[model samples]
Target: MAEKRTGARKSSSDGDDGASSRKAPSKKAPSRKTPAKRAAPKAEAPRRATATQVAARAAQQLLELTGKEAEGVTGLGRADDGWTVEVEVVEVRRIPNTTDVLALYEVTTDDHGDLMGYRRLRRYTRGTPGGE
Candidate 1:
């Protein structure tokens, strides 16, 4: 009769006893690739002021410097450095509204509507024809 073995059998490969011979999976972390850098956005140029804005700015500035009330804007155009605006203002008040003294001022302003300079072009009564 053959005798039965009571203990576990041994593995011949690594000379290990009949515990698991396979190694546990490694716990190492995965390596990551860095992202590429992006280019910076370009800046925009400043916008020029509109005719209406330039005219209004010129009138207000003339009033502040001359201490006279602006009556109206007669002419507006672009200049080499900025804008040229013609503004009418009351220089002297009179009993009759039509006889009041008025002046025409040429005002210059920058691209952003900031007044650079101003000069009186002509002066006449409000009743004068064509302001000549």
Candidate 2:
């Protein structure tokens, strides 16, 4: 009769167990070349200012220059490099509210709403008509 094995048995698919002190050569698949990825386009910036922004900028610049608060924005226009704005500023306060003096200033700013320069066009009392 044949004798039975008592320990682990070896199989045909089993790899080297280091008992034989031998190694098997490794195999690798061929590498594939891929195309490079493209970068996303950059966003563009605005070249002009909005009506609200223009008005606010004009009033702010006027107050800074004259040290008096701005009454309001009277006019706004777009120029080659920036904007043309007309701002009304309180120049003098009188005992009679109706006699208070006001000044109209023309302001210029860059495309980014930065003040470039300004000049006072005329002055008038609060009760005056058409600033004349």
| lDDT of each residue in 66-131, candidate 2, tens digit only | 798898888888899888899988899898878999988999988877899999999898968882
RMSD of 2: 7.0
Q: Write the residue-wise lDDT of candidate 1 on 18-126 in tens digits.
A: 2256675878877554444324445567788889988988999899999999999999989888999999999999988889999999998998789998999999998
Could you tell me which 10 consecutive residues in candidate 2 have the lowest summed lDDT? 1-10
Using Cα atoms with residue i matched to residue i, what is each candidate's TM-score against the true structure?
0.65, 0.65
Candidate 1 wrongly placed segments (more than 4 Å): 1-44, 130-132
Clashing pairs in 2: none
